[model samples]
Target: DLNQHIDNEKCTKIRKQIRLKRTKIKKYKKQINDYSQRKHKYEVQKSILKDRNSYSKTDHDATFMRMKEDHMKNGQLKPGYNLQIATNSQFVLFYNVYQNPTDTRTMIPFLNTIQETYGHLPEYIVADAGYGSEANYMAIIDNFNRTPLITYGMFIKDKTKKYKSDIFNTQNW
Candidate 1:
């Protein structure tokens, strides 16, 4: 929904430019393929020639590259950008978006960041399987004295039978 804040006209223009760039890159890809079966000298010359067609080639590549670079710079849309929302006793917003990816390796660092930002730790932490490594669990207990509410590996998905049998006993948590 970040695009919600962007100007409509600007977004349209950017999309149009991206589509045009993609078409150009596609054309270059075919040209490169045609050159591939030729001698190395021919391939090099074709690549050099392709580079000159800025709008048709380099511009297209640059557009995608810039989009990725901008996301990385902002730390809001990286592959590892994890969104963490915290709630207090009444379930009201406490603190959120201590930006990071769900990596057990980063758990302590991010927990530290949250503490620095909010001046304290939540009584417990909850995260999906991505953040369920031993390192993160230990850090939560040792550093924060908190039990991380992680999904137990024993749970199985079964929606059909209500008031279920022994297969769906205590392991369903």
Candidate 2:
């Protein structure tokens, strides 16, 4: 047989080469599996963080926002919720936890939630300049049929002496 004719040294050399190739193949398979697992983990994290700028790894639902007290004082964003609370007299009327950090986009939704949940609407709603905008005023007047006592963005600036004394000011005209 041809197998019987092969030299022992040549046969052993061939077996060693085959073993080396097998080890390389196994390593490649393991690397491919590792890559696949990493890709799957990234996809899952992305799904959890939909539409958010950043999310806390410790708390998946928590979004990163600037806190009122920044211990670091470097404007470092920490994971937290934007809490909107409405109070009448001394008691709490309605409160909401929002994912977005800005208060600008929250006023309308806060009013809508109160109306839907409690089946009531107040005649006059008071809010700060941060919640003031033309769109918010229109929604309050038209959609909610309520009066908004919200200060416009330039309300404070308009009260300045320079602005009040200027004859060329639009309000003066």
Report lDDT (CA) for all predictions: 0.57, 0.86
Question: For candidate 1, what is the lDDT?
Answer: 0.57
Count clashing residue pairs in model 2: 0
Model 2 ranges with Cα > 4 A deviation: 1-34, 163-173
Writing each residue's lDDT as its tens digit, candidate 2 over 3-69 gives: 3333343667786766676678789999999999999999999999998888999998889988879
TM-score of 1: 0.36
- Give TM per candidate: 0.36, 0.72
C-alpha displacement of 70 in model 2, angstroms? Answer: 1.5
Best by lDDT: 2
Residue 129 miss distance in model 1 (angstroms) = 2.2
For residue 151, model 1's alpha carbon misses the true position, in angstroms, by 2.0
Model 1: residues with Cα > 4 Å off, grouped in runs: 1-80, 88-103, 152-173
